[model samples]
Target: MAPSKKMTFSRRSFLKSSALASGGMIIGFNLFNACKPEAKLPVDLSALNYNDFNAFIKISEEGKVTIFSPNPEIGQGVKTSMPMIIAEELDVLWEDVYVVQAPLDTKNYTRQVAGGSQSIRFGWEPLRQTGATAKQMLVNAAAARWGVDASECSAKNGVITNVKGDKLGYGDVVLEAAGLEVPEDVTLKDPKDFTIIGQGKGNVDIDKIITGKPLYGLDYKEEGMLYATVLRPPAFGQILESFDDSEARALPGVVDVITIGEKVRAYNDSGKNSWTMPMSGTDKVVVIGKTTWDAMKGKKAIKAVWKTETALESSETHDKVLLDLLEGNKFNTRRQDGNVKHAFANADKVLERVYESPFLPHNCMEPMNFFANVSPEKVRLVGPVQTPEAAAQVVADLLERDLEDVSIDMTRMGGGFGRRLYGDFVYEAAEISNAIQKPIKLVSSREDDMTMGVYRPSSKYKISASIKNGKITGYHLKEASINGNMYGLIPNFFPAGAIENYQVDTANYKSNITTGAWRAPYTNFLASAEQSFFDELAEELGIDRVQMHMNLLDNVKNNPDANIEYSPERLQGVLQLATENSNWGKTEAGVFQGLSVYYCHNTHVAEVADITMEDGVPSVKRVTCAVDCGIVVNPFGAMNQIKGGVLDGIGHAMYADFGFVDGVPKSNNFDSYQMIRMGQTPQVDVYFIESDIDPTGLGEPTLPPIGAAVANAIYAATGNRINKQPLINNLEPKEKVLG
Candidate 1:
């Protein structure tokens, strides 16, 4: 036994501007190689050891391997999986490995935030290396003590033993090994020999989540943090005429009332067809207070008026404005696949339909909030953010300080769904803090979160399919008018060369309403239109729904056209598994089930919806899903995401998720903007594909297809095609929607 010299080093993390903020890394596609999944080792725990990290793995003279993870634990369970990588290499019992979040630094940790579903995938290699390398170093230390060659010394279940059976617990060897420099290029476990990794593990933070621990941004509170609420414009394209904040400033707990104005260059095009971020609007009162409730109440008392220049917030204005834009009289052309005029010119059976989607609020359970303390010398920004690096950069620029002067501490996100990714809120917090010269937490009331947010832009799709005999040919999707293309990650991630005589065009019109990313971005809308249309086409061909989807996926997988990229194995498995699980061709009593499959976030998911009608209204009873996200770290967490996403899809697909008048969002609260209740939560069955294909994303992929599946089921139940969303509830068809 020897004395431990020292055991500590600062953690390393890479900080970069987010694509959601400035096109550094696109949301849907990989601008960074770090977002892709790495191949995983099989589950087998044979040869293992632990070395320099052995000190960190101290046993108190008892025994434990402290697996320090460089990634954050938001909801997805990397805090558990990262330790499993080390446990496999250390030959330690699962219960003995205590996982801890790594501290922040640039050189030590990998990409720390969770996004693009790359957590488990990117962590597979580096974490495994971290474990395996430590094991080898420990084995060397153990062999030296036993007077034996390293090869003759084997590690198993936290104990290193020589051929002669001389044993040393990991705790005993830590002190001697900490002095030796760790060797680079230490052998990593072979795919066949891996034990703990690639196996299903429970979430590391389950206790925290279940016992109502402070694991989310909403729970964060620090000394000297004040609360605040702002008055944003009621409608988009409106300007602040004037304000009377005399009453607001006099309110209890109200420290000051401040007014802000929208400044230019607050947002950049992140490059998805004029899809831009927001500039913190200065059209209202700001109530600074000792508590959130006080600040929010004070904001309501402020008297203000904003001039509605574009269109008054009215339902008729909404209808008239959207109808004129759908006539293809807009500026932004999101995507143009082929000569739509030429194709429509030669078409025989041109099936044309128009589908409308209302504006969507992100509706994260936790409201939007940010905390900032700004001064002339330094700036500190803290919040639950999807893009900490992006927020830091924005703060530095806005404060006119060096990038290093700004420090951002990212807290656990209650949910991103895409709303927390914006830097405007971060910018606003900084500005308010700078103006007041104090530490303040900018909080949004549920109503403010709805109104002030850059929502999922309202859109309408006009699709035309050219079907000829039993075998079909040409297809074209002409997206009518929308504010911003959600496919900011790629110009077109979908509707690519799978169809020969096809065209996918998008047109965006200017509106006072602001827009940003929602879950699955444009994919949810694409799936609703494309998959439902496919069902309609299949009905015309008199083909089985399962077989029809299989044929399409088969053609795409067999020859991906080399342009569009996705794992064929994953796509086929989702299709096959979902088909098998749902008993696709079987018929239920008064129920009809519809199916849809899609690929995104580097993962493939297929969903089948069981629909039933009661009292003339259709309801989703159950949804069975098959997902192949490469490797799932925490089975429970992944299932939670699948279940949550499925219900989220069902809620939006069946109800009016967004209520907008002119450019203003009408649904500001739960009463107006409905959410899926407990009664609506159907039985969800999620199946994971058996593979070691690295980790793909889980947060978003499950979302795109559920809406389409529900729509397809409605098609099966009624002779009417539900290509348009909200099911076009007027079943009697008293007066038809004139095209």
Candidate 2:
């Protein structure tokens, strides 16, 4: 349990490649790459190795099956669920087949990152195939031992049985089967006979989790491991100029204070700074200590110089900049259907609305941290990463080593929330490890985590509709401040020629706040703008919002009018159930109602929130959600995720906001950056549409609707739309704003 004392490492190698060795069984074989395709290769089986380890089964000499999952187990319960996929296929009890966070090895892991709510969805197919293939091989091995036909043998619960009732445990037969050539093109079990795939499987480690077992990135420990505190730039275009580490070096437990000059390469063609901090790769400050608190306390005394922004955007001037740009009317042609302008010009009545949103953050429970022991020849990285392959490349680049030398071990995450997608932190760890020539555990203080977090970008939506005789003939959308990465992916789905008489043009501008993927990314903001506008559009036409969406679904259900990639039937089903369950329009009193539907992560969801004014605030009394994520696996977990996501999204919309002063962020802690408490959670009702479709993702599917749903409700109550984000009383007002 003590950290390995292998000190042969003179210079930290950012990439560490070792052979596959665990529990006494070593399985290694053919790999397809630039080098070899038809050859059997050696691999490292250690807990954290960069070598190929496609083998799923690791049998102990005493007989226990361990399944290695290449994906990180962020708090979405994937540590429990992804293992269940292998267990279902391997026919082992959840406890019997232990799960280990997979190491970074490209040959063994495909789609190793656990982001975009893809842990379960991505592993579904391969895990199934793994189980079926293993079972088949075990059956074949048993049949040969019994001198019988393979077809007459059956495999179950890690055992192979014959017609005459001969049986053997999986471990007893693997050695024999390992020698035989694995059959190609093996058939899998039919859905009707899936004993565990579709059945309710609980979180395998619920007891450990509920009892406070050490199972998170924050809880990991290594002997002689030094904690590091990094000092980064406060804003864009900032650079380190000078520093004095003498006072820091004198502090208790202070090992070293490093001034690293991190440089990001500019594009050869454009020759622009790739980014400001992580993206731009500014040099950093490293404060080493025996403990996190000591390191942080000592970090303050380490004086350093930094350059202020040049030719840049500031938070105070960002709004004005976008407003000025809007007047210029420069927008990309996202979608164009019919003669939208002419139709709007000739319409009997026209409705227009504008909505605004503020910047956001992904405050994950486990602030970014990665444990690394890097060297120029090889490196070892152990952390929770969404993209293991990408992390591999990063370590290789940072250490200036061969890609094959880098090793990564993905641990279970306390919470990913899409924040783990960025591998920049991993780069820092590798850099510091290589710099100090010692293994280092790079950690971010809560302040560092919040202030330097890649924030969700803000935007404004301008929607216009042409209404003639109570029928929508044309629609137009002009969205501004669309600087988030979603802009790159959105146009591919909803570009020109998707809808009739429709025009969608978006203009992007810069802001002081940094941007990264949040839950549902653009959908989080898009739903709030698009859905709320649609709700108002339906009201103007005096039509039910559900019906209006259904009309749109009709267009996309068969042949999608927009180039959007979503199953219309699934989306419509969510709307169908939400309307039916909420007793739509069949209730009375001062209750405010709002409805919305959006699709993401291969799932569709519709939500209807019922609200009533409580103490001059729009408090949700109840919410009815209808979701169809294909066939449910662990239906209870699925439902729990839906319930949890709805509440999380609700809290984020109602209270979560990250502000800025000059170049630094304000409200950097939980005390100021509040989250939704249990007391605030409303009565929630969730319904999963009955279907035979394979299960879809649930982690991010429920978040996109909350902001729009709540905003719509507040509008119904006061008839004055609340356009901005963090609908709260906490703020630094420009015109001395009021709640």
Best prediction by lDDT: 2
Candidate 1 residue-wise lDDT, 1-739, digit = tens:
1221122221211111111121111101111223223212111112111110111222323556655454545555666766776678667888777765543222122355566667767666555555555566667878888778888988888788898888988767755554444554456555456556556677766687899987666677779888878787787767778888888878888888886543223333222112223653444567898898888888889888888766645545555566666675543444455565665566666677777777778878788788899877788877777666556666665566787678666666677777876766777788788878999998887888887787777677766776655544566666644454555223234434454565555666565566777888877677777777777777777898767666655555665452565655566678889888887768568888888878887788889998876655567888889998865655766787788778888887777556566657777888876777789778998888876566677877887788888887776666556655555343435233111
- Give candidate 1 regions above 4 Å deviation: 1-74, 86-91, 100-111, 190-195, 198-200, 261-277, 280-284, 308-348, 375-377, 488-497, 557-562, 567-569, 728-739
lDDT of 2 by residue, 175-202 (tens): 5665554555455555565566566767
State, as a TM-score between 0 and 1, how close model 2 is to the true structure: 0.88
The deviation in Å at residue 500 for candidate 2 is: 1.5
The TM-score values for the models, in the order shown, are 0.83, 0.88
RMSD of each: 8.7, 7.3
